[model samples]
Target: MADGTRIVDLEAVPEDGSYRLTAEDPFGNETELILVRCDGEPGVRAWSNTCPHESQSLDVGDGAAIRDGAIVCPRHGSHFDACSGECDDGPAAGTTLPGVDLAVADGAVHLADDRYAFLHEGGIDDDEPGSTSHLSL
Candidate 1:
């Protein structure tokens, strides 16, 4: 679980809610993120704590709470829509959170290999042999 490998813990996550996780990137960069369960279903949303506007962690204060189906950032009072990671308020309006591609299977969270590339807005070559992106832990 510490090596960016796919590890799922379904039982540890509750349905119809959100959970915060501290993870590391493949380069060992620690990131605080949130996972939300919108509605009674098992859908999950993953986004980094770093706000796109100022690169500040959005997990601070009461900003992590779910409001109108989005996660609010405590620092500058920005609201990140969970489903789309778009900002709904403050100076960063129309911006988006760094989205982390994740899925739920067998009752655990699984980080997608290509998610980081999307978050970074980088392109992947077709000749690549393996996934170019990975979570550190």
Candidate 2:
């Protein structure tokens, strides 16, 4: 993860829709992030593709449906708010999905590729369960 590299093209992602991309943080932890355009909105929202309940990648295809402005995980029927990442149902209900810090700048989506840079700098190990690590977006 460098300082000025673009993560994903915002134009490539459909407006009022969702897309998935795989990224590797500085520590080599690979994570899938889902970028979604909230209904009738211009900016994009992002969340970890991994479901907290079973650590399975949420279905990002047709299985990922938008209902009431939330992205629904098809595997366990969990609905997450596209803007806030709040789980609305299923086993992980009330649990919030991890947010991928990103922003639109210079007409492109800029994501902090090194999600665990802070943790590593703070002497934290990224491989440990429940470790404070960052997600690549």
Candidate 3:
């Protein structure tokens, strides 16, 4: 609603998964964000896609496993609250995922943080077919 870059339709985000998008900071660093339907007023929230425990991505294309309102880390299984991005029951407990500002209005999701500009509709490595994993597999 504030003339920010529109990222996606609100309904496009799967109820069980997240919508991935990339954004560039004012300094020109790109970061991936994961969007999920939240449980309250704004109805949507976003966090940097990295898990605090091992820096593993929360969503790996198919979607981050959402269970009981938390986004499960694909590598270590830590659960970050989809709404608050806080972890309270895993090795990543006491840590919070970095949040990316978002706004929902008129059935669309917009990049509301002035610090970031929307780059594209996927992760940083989406254009390349190489492994983003640290392990050489």
Candidate order by lDDT, highest to lowest?
A: 3, 2, 1
Q: Which candidate is the best by TM-score?
A: 3
Those runs of model 2 whose alpha carbons end farther than 4 Å from true positions after fitting are: 1-4, 39-42, 60-63, 116-137
Each prediction's TM-score versus the true structure: 0.63, 0.69, 0.89
Q: Which candidate model has the greater lDDT, 1 or 3?
A: 3
In terms of lDDT, which candidate is strongest?
A: 3
Off by over 4 Å in 3: 128-137
Off by over 4 Å in 1: 1-17, 39-42, 61-63, 114-137
- Count clashing pairs, candidate 3: 0
- Mind sharing the TM-score for model 2? 0.69
**Clash pairs for candidate 3:** none
- Collision count for each candidate, in order: 3, 1, 0
Q: Give model 3's TM-score versus the native structure.
A: 0.89
